[model samples]
Target chain A: MTQVSDAPAKTRAQISQKTLRTDRWWEQPAIVATLLTIWVTYATVHVFIGKWYWVPQYHYLTPFYSPCVSGECVPGAASLGTWFGHLPPIIPYAVVSLPFVLGFRLSCYYYRRAYYRAFWRAPAACAVREPHQKYTGETRFPLIMQNLHRYFFYMVILISILNTYDVIQAFHGKTGGIGFGLGTLIMLVNVVLLWCYSLSCHSCRHITGGRLKHFSKHPVRYWIWNRISWLNARHMQLAWTTLGTLMLTDLYIWLVAAHVFSDFRFYN
Target chain B: MSYKAALRVWRGDHGRGDLADYAVEVNEGEVVLDVLHRLQATQAGDLAIRWNCKAGKCGSCSMEINGRPRLACMTRMSTFTEDEVLTITPLRTFPVIRDLVTDVSFNYAKARQIPSFTPDPSVGLGEFRMQQADVERSQEFRKCIECYLCQNTCHVIRDHAENENAFAGPRFLMRVAELEMHPADTADRRDIAQDDFGLGFCNITKCCTEVCPEHIKITDNALIPLKERVAGRRYDPLVWLGSKIARRPRSTGTPKVPDNRH
Candidate 1:
């Protein structure tokens, strides 16, 4: 490296302080840590609770238990068929899909930034010094697994299709007519947000139009790419929004299933 | 509307420093730079500062105002309340030369590391014709004033001095993105971006984007797209399989321009 004339003769200033920033730099990371911890704790407990995940009357199944593939599931809840027989309490009923969902969020570009800053304290905010001395980032071993985000993207697409199917089945009424209710509306909103989040993924954008030499040649792909690009700009917002929607959808179903409150029927 | 604004400016050389307090005159239309200039003129003539184009365009007067990276020329004094002590400090990411000036050669070094745009051999000068859409794709990045605010704000090199040798911060990474997106450029920058430039170190925190004065979506338009382009070559299994089947060399020196380009 060529040393320029104005290069600093000394190393970084030997100030014995971690940072000179006086702003509330820690607030953002603290909020992120608190929210993520709460979400993870809730998700873990609900995934294992296994009961009150289905309401047979309204066909309202919490996303946490969708495609509930166990013989223990309520008869109508096992829409995808019970591939797994009665298992021990340790495993989740949606075990097949849960890992892929977890992997999708774990490897998402936006979520990666959130967790890395919040949980890992990788310079929690800009200019803040982190505790760790050596930073290899995603170059080696466990972190290199982040490159599998594209694969997780693919898996999440398949799971989204299944989630869409669950939404379709959710149209059932108590009287067996086409149903529309508060549960249906909540599930509909959740599924729509899920699609928005998935479609706006960086991997999806790449698959749609990336690597193409000329946009003129692929008009169809170009159109889709442009739309995805718009959504891609809001990927961070969509990521957090979907998490909230997913929890809300699951919680609504859990409450209905547990008979905490009856589903508010808009029509039957 | 004129009053004495309490200003705290970091003072000292590369060896050591501490914040020095001053009461500088401030007028309604004046900026932080104006106040600093007044301080320099009246109180301390020896105070060191670097500035060019008192307008925000030159990007030479980058400093931290109350722990935020900003161009002193752009920050109005009216934004601060009367009681608030306006603390101006040099950028934390780089070595300070004196008060409010740091050796930004770190950015220049990173800029030198990136290979410049290598146009396709087939496309002669003046023969290059680009669609408007294609031109606009990279034009957003061209607005960068090289303030190095993005560099100073990026946590990769800011906190971890060890990673300085590898990571090329957001500004130069955006430069690579610009070249990579250029329809005529032929040289493959994906490998160099991931391997040599330490693009992986950027976890898309968006701090660079947040600090950008140009409002360039550095994380969205440049970095993420560049990362996707790299992934297409390195990680996509289908692309890997197709490349193996076709027996095509990865870094062939030809641009991927479609034959339709006139």
Candidate 2:
């Protein structure tokens, strides 16, 4: 604490601040790093092992493979037509859109801070200094790409819309009738959380509703802005939730597609 | 009825210091500041502490009780068990002047760096029309009492002394946000925010929001929106080119003050 004595009175000496925190400061960042690493590992493995990311019977597509661009999609699974004729074997169909999705998260304000603090330990917690002599911020080359978050925000909206379509398609089972299943619910929850994350984005909030002159003139926009404001308040929570559910949605389809365990179908 | 509590308050100057223990009697409704006042009245007449309203409103009594930044007048005596040693210390992020007092002129210096609201003259002659809806969020940000609690809690400059030159902590950031979001304010500050104010330094850990006594959503509402403005206008390749084209000598009548937005 800063203490400059006033007058001729007894006062102890002052200490320069190194780390003023007393609680378990490192524990939170360590745990966040662990959780993020697990998610990243799972995502990387699944993105590469891409075969089991689809369940043709349920029209269920894991987020990693949504807008499944490769012709290798299981018969009838490439609901969106293959852009290039089916890929040569070995390459995953999901590779096409995954970059944009990953970019969305990488450029996310919350995740940017999370990884910067947790992984890089740049002032990891309140009142704890990093070893670095300088902070370049997101100003240079690759880090500068973080400013593309607004564009990434736009792309995620498009990807989320595609995911929404896949989820809608999931409602129709193999028999071409409305169906509900563990996988359908999984895709549903995944899309919902994805929307929450995207809509809660600071960029999304700003574009859709912020920086306004008269919200009164734009009543509908203002209303949506307020609801989004509610979501943005918990943006960090939704960001983490989307990651967990995104992993679960992919895992459920992976298991069901691999026939490791059949999807528990409720209706078809 | 009164309860006995042991208080370990930091006592020192810039040269050296340690925790000095004081046993004080506290009433049920009293707060940490009341205990300090009691300590002043009874045992330690020479002890120094900063305070104003004695209520939580003025924000004059901001100090860390235990490890968290808070208003000493707001934290209740009952919140702690009688045995817990109440560690009262000055705000850790600043340099101390005496016990429980740190020189917060750093914030004032940062405040002077900001340009005040400059409205577009074309809008009106005297009156301006702002929809309540448009002004709502700015109103929330205006609730800030300048307690600097959020500044004290913010990590951007708290521990990283090197960042002090570039980064303006949560309080001034909120000020910028309030003005930027103002309905009539038309001066473009996006580039200034990014390049000068170091808006990119904040990672939005929410510690500032957690410590705010006024419940301002410093991270989500102000800082993040300000960031979007920075990202939207300042870094866009097209806007970058456009601004380069529009760049001219700064005699647009807007007083060529030495771009103190830093």
Best by DockQ, which number? Answer: 2
> How far in Å is the alpha carbon of B196 misplaced in model 1?
1.0
RMSD of 1: 4.3
Stretches of model 2 off by over 4 angstroms after superposition: A1-27, A83-92, A129-131, A176-178, B121-126, B238-262
Candidate 1 segments exceeding 4 Å error: A1-10, B247-249, B253-262
Specify the poorest-scoring 10-residue window by lDDT in model 1 chain B: B253-262
CAPRI level of candidate 1 = acceptable
DockQ metric, candidate 2: 0.38
lDDT (tens digit, per residue) of candidate 2 on B206-243: 77888898998888889888887777665667556666
Give the alpha carbon lDDT tens digit for every residue of B144-243 in model 1: 9999999988878777776776787899999988898888887888888887778888888888998898899899888988888888778778778878
Window of ten residues with lowest summed lDDT in model 2 chain A: A1-10
TM-scores vs. true structure, each candidate = 0.94, 0.88
Question: Model 1 scores what on Cα lDDT?
Answer: 0.84
Candidate 2 lands at a TM-score of 0.88
Instruction: State which candidate has the highest TM-score.
Output: 1
